[model samples]
Target: MARAPGFWFRQPGPWSAALAPLGAIYAAGTARRLSRGGRARVGVPVICVGNLNAGGTGKTPTVIALVQRLSDRGIRAHVVSRGHGGTEKGPLRVDPLRHAAARVGDEPRLMAAFGPVWVADDRVTGARAASDTGAQAVILDDGFQDPALAHDLSIVVVDAAKGWGNGRCLPAGPLREPVATGLARADMVLSIGGGHAQRQFAARWPALPVPHLTARLQPLKTGMDWTGLRALAFAGIGHPEKFFATLAREGVEIVRAEALADHQPFSPRLLTRLEGEARMLGAQLVTTEKDAARLPDDFRGKVLTLPARLRFDDPAELDRRLDALFD
Candidate 1:
């Protein structure tokens, strides 16, 4: 991933202050776009899982969790994404069996295992297509800031470890827009992982009106003996360290942790090198599900994947919110 500025997480420094003018411009442009909203509304309800930060805040997993919940409630839910790294600018349905990450992007390929996934640069087109097929509800993986499609519910996710770094927008900090402005549009604020960031945010804005929800990513029981297994863990997600930390939490002895740019394509040479390094260190290769989806077919069996699911602190509260969408 492109390295974030050091001052992003820290208190405002000279560099952040110097970049404040640009940040203001960026924030203003976002506000102006939001103000002139003409979002297309499909017949089915749309739930948006988005984040204030540019990078991953566990939005994909959150979407998966929500989809599962909707499925359990007998709702036919489908997912829509921007196909961030793919070449196709299409309103195409993702087929895990036929499509590679190169075609539909890694996250959509992974998400397709759960249900239908559609990739289109224009979310409205994708949502319309999904709804026209059989979708009772649509889940937007990102695009909280995009004013292209109307959303029934907007859930903004924030990583508890990296809450509103420096509280500045864009170039000055990590926020895509000002926190308050984004929060004003969000129906719920989901704090993923521990409550530290949520606590910090509350301290920063005690009067914030949005409902706060807490959740953590729990590793799905793979039924494999992972205890004491030495692993060379690597991830190419928005927050790779989070993946490494998850492996460590699951009792895997991490020999080395590698972080590549988000949605990075793993070439044959890189995979061979990673396998060789793992062998040299007497460790097995392991990666996140999204990264595993990007691996070539021949190399996939060689690497183990650690899959995780979102566990909400209050499922009833979430159910109530979801229920409101359909009601």
Candidate 2:
């Protein structure tokens, strides 16, 4: 997978044009499979919290928020993911402490805290494990495109800032599936952030049949010092720009900022070099909580970590929708 920035934007020219016919054929086959309706074994409700666009549409945070809401209402929610970027083979349980980013993937590890989490290549297998574990509901993170495990509710997440990059798919754009395909299958559209993001969604999908809810991402109250301190911030998330923007909003002075691939694994040498760079620039080294989890335990304490959370401004309406999931 390509890194955050150019992965979505750096579309190929003539080469991709030559392959466009083939891409369309493949997309058609996959979309047809997704449209089928026979595999759904709805022992418990399966809610898919996904995004139409690839990379960072804040799908992880949305899943986390939904998991928390489900637990609050005395419902047992289990989470299942394909465990993208991890090396595991079959169905496996995600233990945040034991499994590194290489084992359970970045997002699954983060979601494991809110409920029972399972990772498997075959989502149906993962769902079976969750059901066996006594989970009343299964929240599939980033699995809307997968057709095997039928979802009862599919909520598509849209980043207000990026706005579905060039409105194209794969080599041409950021989407894993067509925008209309996701919208058609979705039960709701969650437009995240303010300003351009909200305006873009309103303009493009005003007549969508489902409810369009607005969400805001707020940094958790991390009592870290952000006052007038020069620092070097780095992230391997889908959208490093958001990370930098959050730091700026919190009054964190960024002297140097670096962006890497989503869920990049940094070695000891790389960590040492970053520390050296920070020291040379008279700044502290910092990164997002997702990146922090990948850092080796020996070097984790040396760097400052920032945690961010997604909060819905109007939560009452969300509560009602979540209630309907269990009903």
Candidate 3:
């Protein structure tokens, strides 16, 4: 996806006010679509990890964390995705080895690393496929706005630091739907950030109607110490700035930070250019695990990967909801 306009996060200024009329139309269309009937339900429970904002707000990691939590309790969870950036058109299982991000999209490819994943434009079809394939429960990725499949639980994830950007919908701001409208359907709200960011979000939304959950991303242990490591970090995600921040927190000596478009294709030419830049700066190439899924065949092992996993501050409320799904 293209980088969101800067004004989306800013206060209601000329740009936002000028676009407000269009945003109202967009929000109305969303409401009409959501109100449509004939929503389907797969045999198994479907837990949708989605966001109110158009861009990412840690939804991928939230899905990963939920699947991990389900696994700990012996539930087989499968991920069903829309394959946003890929060319795939069917409800097919993703095999990380056989499928490239170019085919199945980066998010689905990365999620497949943890468990079974299905990619299809029609989310309802994908959810059904997951249920038929022994998925005790299915995690519908980024489909809160789509009303085709009825989700047992809906989670709206937000970057605590970037909460509801200007609180407007669509072209006027980052929101896909108005805050109040979306929250009315959401079973929970997850705000991902550090201690300070989390506290600030809570203070800002003290009356957030849904259960508010908080979490922070922590790098998964791979035995490769990141302390003082000299690196040229590049990230192609909805929020590359966050990835750079993660690197800084890990004690990486960032020689240069390159922010690429979300799911930016890694062609050979681009890879060579990035590699040359890293060599000239005497820094190793580093990237996020999501970007690593899109790396070319030869450069896959060469570039360093720092994979972060979401660790919820408290999962008691979350667990209670998950338990309710079975009961």
Candidate 4:
């Protein structure tokens, strides 16, 4: 996938202005598709964790966090995803031990580590499969724009650092649909990380009645001491810089940082080059959990994965929302 246009993050530039007409067309199509709502409903409650932007807004992590919360409340929640970047296109269960990221997609494989996961281009099929398999609830990762399945609750996640990105749609900007349309349907707005973009978004849409929640990605302990360690950190994610920033906060001495496109496939030649570079700098290889999931089996032991969890600003508030959904 191509990197998001820089103009998306800035105010409407000449390029965004030039493409505004195309954006209007895309927005209109989305609105029309959403209006034809004959969504298939499953037996259990379905919660959608999605975003308005085309790029990552930490949806996978949010799904994992919500699934864990559901488990804590004794709710068997299964996750449904489109399995982007993978070859599979079916209503299939993700077996983390048996499936590779190349087949099931990185996010689904990572989510499978937390709970049962289903991969399907048709989300309605995926949700039905989850329910048939005894899931009490279903979590739809990146499915807010998908109207084929009914959702009991919709929570839109926004990267606080990259809010709305010029607020245009498709080829013109980063949005998948217009922000106002998304907000109108959203039950809650989850702002992840701390940044001015989120503040600006809030100020710009003060009349929105959705409950706003704040959360941060907290790195989990890897049991390996990171202090004073020279490391070559690499990431293939929506924002690789975020991973690098997290490593810096953990006090890991980054000898080098490499940013690859989101969901970039790791070939043997590329892994060899990265390993050589790490060896040259006398540094250990470290990467985010999502990237680590895509590594070939041979490279698995050589790379250290930095796992992260979502820490809500108000745990009670999150609990109440979840409780309301389940109850």
Candidate 5:
């Protein structure tokens, strides 16, 4: 299991101190590669929405938001993804209703609502599928680290709450690539949450030459009733705490809380264990939409899924950005 940022950042031992040098090396290599142009020559234009971190930074919702915006402008868009946890081979087009989460992965299923969504381990192949489906432009979800596809534009999504965590890579920190590296390649930096991290980034990285936008995490609904109800909350997201926090906000009485690694595939045995625990606690199982997508069909209906959306306060600005992408 990966150690939490609070766990490592609080440690002051020699081992923790020793890792800084290696981090410098990792950061340098990251910067070198990101400095290169991500020029693509595909028949259709490609826009990449990705992040510097390994885990979630609102990229999925951003993809959805962009798809919606593009559609409004008479631009027929499609999405291509790696299908992170789903068990599938070769390139496949996601038919939202027909394809369950187990087949095409959760994000693609969600993206399919806006436009054609295709998944493949081979991104180039997926792009081809999107093209065949009549997509004028393809949105590459989480492809910032993928250098194979030439992206016409790249947008870097950063979690305002966890701003590059200790600014290190892999085992030492949460960054998949260094911040400077991602910023150098990005056409824009989208900061989620109107917090100090976003403000600090603007002050310190003013020379990045990319436009910065502030966004926030919004609940899908105004409220949910959990009065006189016992609940067991579990999630396989970047931060399980965020899910728990949302439950708390909804007034859910969480009798038991469980967390799994990000993008964890659910097994019948695992769901059985959770169901047993829920019964013991006299509670119903509840989870995030992403986690619910990974559950087997037999157990899916038993799980309470809380769907979420990415709502921008000034949605017109985001729409304007998509218009700029095509222009």
Candidate 6:
């Protein structure tokens, strides 16, 4: 949605306690919606890379990784996205040269680089269009709760350290659905983080019903090294801190960190302000690749981008799981 409320991640306090009743209603609504039968099925497998939380939890990279892996197997995989931040209500195929993030959403724009992407408010229509256009498989981007298309496989992606955030729903917490209920429907849970974060995640959920897959985000090796580079890092993703942490891991000297709302629009006024700050700080403006997708053409080159992709800890397991759908 928007920038998640701070109280959602923090220990449950008066705010969460006060909002508990509302959270219950929201949770029940989600359960009732998901429990409904007749979720539309398509000809090809619909693999959803979604999350428990309302906002981002590394779903984009996960989809990118899946698309790349599936391509290696000669599968013509296409992405179907709801186009969160865009105005287009369509099963329109995304052409990076034509469609801006303002039209098709940033995540879909990024995914288009890997494979054919369709931006449709109605996911079923999008998946169908992709299948008709020769897609061997359709990858649903963040439609775990939408239930627009019947998924052959649903992978719930989570931040290893932020395990459901106080274990409540909506205003009371960060979850889109309750942990227990969400996990029961998931075919697999992909935990994204470094070793320490994964360790903490494992300690939290000692035993999961579904297969537990672990992965980490690594720099994409684009030949643009940020090591020892003093830069002002700015991002407008769901969890900007994660991007900042990635930069730190890459050995970038962060002179300043600006965290904006998820899918935040970049206006000329805002760009001017950041430009002034960078000028004064004597540091180059830096941002995540996803955020850079939204930047104006004139300003994009001015901002350095650190692109990353997800690397699964055990690819054999993923391959086995994916192979089953084909079988």
Best by TM-score: 3
Q: Model 6 residue 253 lDDT?
A: 95
Score every model by TM-score.
0.96, 0.91, 0.98, 0.96, 0.86, 0.97
lDDT of 2: 0.79
Q: Least lDDT summed over 10 consecutive residues: which range in candidate 5? A: 1-10
lDDT of 3 at 188: 95
Candidate closer to the true structure by lDDT (higher is better), 1 or 4: 4
Off by over 4 Å in 6: none
lDDT of model 5, residue 287: 94
Look at candidate 2 and give me any clashing residue pairs.
160-197
Q: RMSD (Cα, Å) of candidate 4? A: 1.5
The predictions' CA RMSDs to the true structure, in order, are: 1.4, 2.5, 0.9, 1.5, 3.1, 1.2
Candidate 1's TM-score: 0.96
Clash counts for the predictions, in order:
1, 1, 0, 0, 0, 0
Evaluated against the true structure, the overall lDDT of model 1 is 0.89
Poorly placed runs, candidate 3 (over 4 Å) = none
Q: Is candidate 4 or candidate 5 better by lDDT?
A: 4
| Pairs clashing within candidate 3 | none
lDDT of each: 0.89, 0.79, 0.92, 0.90, 0.76, 0.90
- Model 5 lDDT per residue over 1-327, tens place: 232556333334455457767766776776676566654455888989998876877898888888887887889888889887677665898887788777788778767777888888888788888888798899999878776788877888877667566666655666767677667778887877645656765664465667777787666774666554678999888778777877777778889889888777677788889999999988999998777766777788888877777766565555666677678
lDDT of 6 by residue, 211-307 (tens): 9999999888877777899889999987899899889988999999999998999999999999999999998999998999899889998998988
How does candidate 4 score on lDDT? Answer: 0.90
Candidate 1 off by > 4 Å = 195-206
Query: What TM-score should be assigned to candidate 4?
Result: 0.96
Q: Per-residue alpha-carbon lDDT of model 3 for 185-266, expressed as tens digits?
A: 9999999999998887888778999999889999888887899999999999989998999888888999999999998899
lDDT of 1 by residue, 67-97 (tens): 8999998999999998877877879999989
